[model samples]
Target: MSNSTPQKFEFQTEIKQLLDIVIHSLYTEKEIFVRELVSNASDALEKLRHTQLTEKEVFDDNLTLEINVTTDDKAKTITIQDFGVGMTREELVENLGTIAHSGSKAFLQALGESGAKNSNLIGQFGVGFYSAFMVAKSVKVYTHSWRKDAPGHMWSSDGSGTYEIEEAEGQRRGAKIVIELKDDCADFAQDWKIKEILERYSAFVSFPINLNGKRINTVQALWLRNKNEVKDEEYTEFYKFQAHAFDEPRLRLHFSADAPLAINALLFVPKENTEKLGFSRLEPSVSLYCRKVLIDAKPKDILPEWLRFLKGVVDSEDLPLNISRETMQDKSLLEKLNKVITKRFLKFLEEEAKNRAEGYTEFYKEFGVFLKEGAALDFTHKDQLVKLLRFESSLTEKGKTTSLADYVSRMGADQKEIFYLVGPNRASIESGPYLEGFKARNLEVLFCYETVDEYVMNNVREFDGKKLTAADHADVKLADLPKPEGALKDEDVTTLTKWLKDTLGERVSEVKPSDRLVDSPVIALNADKFMSPHMRRIMKAMNKDAETPLRVNLEINPRHAVIKRLFETHTAQPEKAKLVAEQLLDNALISAGLLDDATAMVARLNKLLESV
Candidate 1:
């Protein structure tokens, strides 16, 4: 090939095909073009740094190792510069124009049978370098080799058909790439935007990354440092920077594992949940890293969906990266890594719960939903995450909460069930008749306020050898205490229950003395196996045309004044007794959240008010 002014080179057939795929579909986010280019520049600088250590007479030894980013808004062009190993005219043609120079083909060719068998890479197609054409109309790379006599050269390509190579004059000993962004992608031409993309993807690059002469990646990758060498403030700063949060982390787990898979991780629970404030569902925020190089930000498979709230970085050394590091192949290995790290983080939580009770409580208030989700959805860690849960219980003071372990610790030997009640607040639960028998037995029951809590307990089923029982369930049995003085006589009470059942007829499943009554007169119990009060509410709310039928256990406390009087007044005045019984049942139904027809209850209550 003879060149008069400059030589234009056609890409190898394979590379041309690879370039088309890269420019069209290799990346999901167009901004990745910037990161890919910056990473290449950083790699060149890193190689030059290693070369300077052993080489006595290095070319352009005086040049500093730094990355300079300049954005030209007027020209809609962005430039990335690094003082690293560059290339000469022929080197530029061989390096930038072909895929063989990347060391990928030979590495794959020489890949040992066992090494190739290990499925731990993300990219292998050798087209990641061509991703720049996704958002750039044209790219110009100017580079000078490290050799003293090597002349600087410029490589220009429109990324359409061909690229040109020519000798450039007075170029520094590094690589400078200029990208002319396409019209729609002009946002990269702003200095602030480039700085953000650099900080997110290349913040841990071994060398300094400067934007418009100001240092951008100042924070060191603390995960790579020795645990003792990192100060607490540095960790906090990293957490704030990575989490995009202002408050100190309520909990932090930082550790390293080497056997199963070499992994270093730093995780944090924020001070508050913005989602709890009625914000949208949170997306996964943990970043996956291989040797401090970001692989994927917000990777879905790295952690379970239940861990979406946790924020931090996980740097793994055993991660066999594909060329681009965009995805991973060895899922079983990734699962192993996930298991090890998740277990360790949970163990850290356990330690925090024991050693830092107050701190854990604060964190629980914010991130407990995540644990609840884990308990309900992640069967692999359900038992462990269940133990990590905390809730306010009858045993704990108001505003204080008790964990499942604590509740189990306080459980009586006779109590085989871990009882919980879903309600709007503490007052409503305490005043409800279902709790009377439980309270009389001095049994502690967890109080759940959110709709998801019931769904969680229902899914979890049991924890630590005790069955998780809903305190409001009609089937839950409480020990019957001795009848109070002035209570209805046994024979009369029996006759009255029989007649009330007969009178209420189809509306009543069973009219009987509740085994769990103390202060309240009567309570309605739902006997439907499939539909809980909560499930009923949810289903009814969702379907406007569907009707929810009422089927409940009408329970009577023999000792309560209202029930005692109703028993006596029933045979003496059958008509008024009917009204009084209906009214009493309505009042009980209101408390139990079973009687949907509140119009009738309201009418009866008003009538009774007039009689009074």
Candidate 2:
């Protein structure tokens, strides 16, 4: 069958160095050689697929475009054969015998400089075929080019320094790689091991991959297909297979982008947050891919940290991956990918919030905490994240919520700031004195029940040009309400406030008549502009020094009966007025969550009771 005597050729010096690097230090996983060989076969098949379109006649036209992997545990040999485009003797020497590509040469220089720790540099140099040197004591590649006129050839190498090529008889139309597994890497010769590797790395390959004639890649890479043609059941199936989740995804975003970098992404928001369900914090689940081959299963940098709840695949043909395709080389491109995918998902949420209010509200109920985290931490998307924020407000029914944009739309022209009150529940915030003034003036105050809401508000600072002002802060200035009839004279109000401030002394920052209080007898506001009550609580819980005691301004409603009586009692019974003033201050402090030690307040309350 030999057309001429077998010819032995020394590997190009760079190929020798590359072979040494690959065999000694380049790859961490020896089994990855299977992946490399399979990928090489796939590339050959893909090339032939393109070739068939342009050429009129093709050799072995009836041969199916599929990969067949046969493992022989007994012989300790694994053979992967693809019935696609094969190489001629000259092509094999050119492709396999030398580092013909400049990229591969540069890769070798990088590997040499880095001491061959860069396993991620494998596929970049067109040296994916040489990875078999990692596990193979000897590798034989029998290939017949896809042209009938091109004769069959066999290239053999021990991967030390030289290889041999000779005419081969009765060959097929594509390449078949036979790896004689090394004694230490005999596991790859097992059927189950190869099947698992194929399932992990090549499950979504465009061609059928058969393990001993049984098809393994049963699922398609649905993200690559036109989404309209993919059915709902198909997408659900793909999600289940890709995410390994039993429950269905609550939402899905299937989109493709052409600008900046070509991206095809299919992201899914699960039915429940596993972390919220008492599971550990979720890791990034979005897999990264290039041309249907997986790059990284859990790409840490492809999406922002808050998007860890998302599960899906992001594929970009434009990504410049290092040789092994394990790590992405272009950081800016990855950031662009992150931005594009995140921005698209945000736009999708915005659309859902506007067009499907109830669905978005339900989603917000489950996943809004993540959005709050992004709004507080991710400045680039803060504006979009703020719009997606939802909260119960003074005007909404107990369970109902509204967005900042919606709140702004309902804002009175005279209103210059957005108001929000942080508390445990709707009833608590409404029952408290803070909301009484806002309610009286018909100013809607957003109700924040979760702890992160205040943090989000502080960082967001403003939305649509309206300052996000906490209702309890002393700096908040509500429009003055009309003074009702029977209100105390200005002189009398001034006298009562001065007497109360003097009695309270250091305990109160300022005691004054409130222009905002209506039905409430007294309202409290935090005087420290820098620290809100919630922030103080957070600091205390964290054991961080507050550095200053909480100080608050007490505002009295002169129209209320308590104040009217206090004004008279202060002149008649100064001691009793003192007890009442201390009691009022304690009550206000309790409402504001600033009361650290309440023993004195209890003693004061008993004394006031004796007077009553």
TM per model?
0.69, 0.67
Give the alpha carbon lDDT tens digit for every residue of 1-612 in model 1: 223367778976655655565566545567766666676776677567656754677788999888898999999999989899887777676676776665334323333222322211112222345667888899998888898887777888988778988777778899898889999889989988888788766665657888888988864778878889987777776775565454677777789888788888988887767567443466677888777656666677778888888889898887764423344677887798789988888889889888999988888888888899899999998878998888888878888999888898898888899999888888888778877788888999999987789899989998887899988888887766766677778887789899899888888889988788888888888878778887787787789578888778788888888888888788887877887888878878778766666887677777777766
Candidate 1 Cα outliers beyond 4 Å, as residue runs: 1-67, 70-207, 211-219, 323-327
lDDT to native, each model: 0.77, 0.84
True-vs-predicted CA distance for residue 221, candidate 1, Å: 2.6
Enumerate clash totals for all models, in the order shown.
2, 6
Tell me the deviation in Å of residue 202 in model 1.
9.4
C-alpha lDDT (0 to 100) for residue 510 of candidate 2: 93
Candidate 2: tens digits of C-alpha lDDT, residues 1-612: 667678999999888887888898776777667666776777678667756755788889899889999999999999999988898888888889877642457667655555543445365445778888899999999999998899899999999899999998889999999999899999999899999988766665668999998999864888999999988877776675466454688999999999988999999998877556444466788988787766676778999999999999999998644323335567787899999999999999999988999989888988999999999999999889999999999989988999999999999999999999999898788778898888888999999999899989999999999999999888787777777888889999999999998999988899888877777788778998788888888887787554547788999998999989889999899999999988888888888888878999988888888876
Model 1 CA lDDT for position 130? 67
CA lDDT, candidate 1, residue 158: 82
lDDT, residue 24, candidate 1? 66
The TM-score obtained by model 1 is 0.69
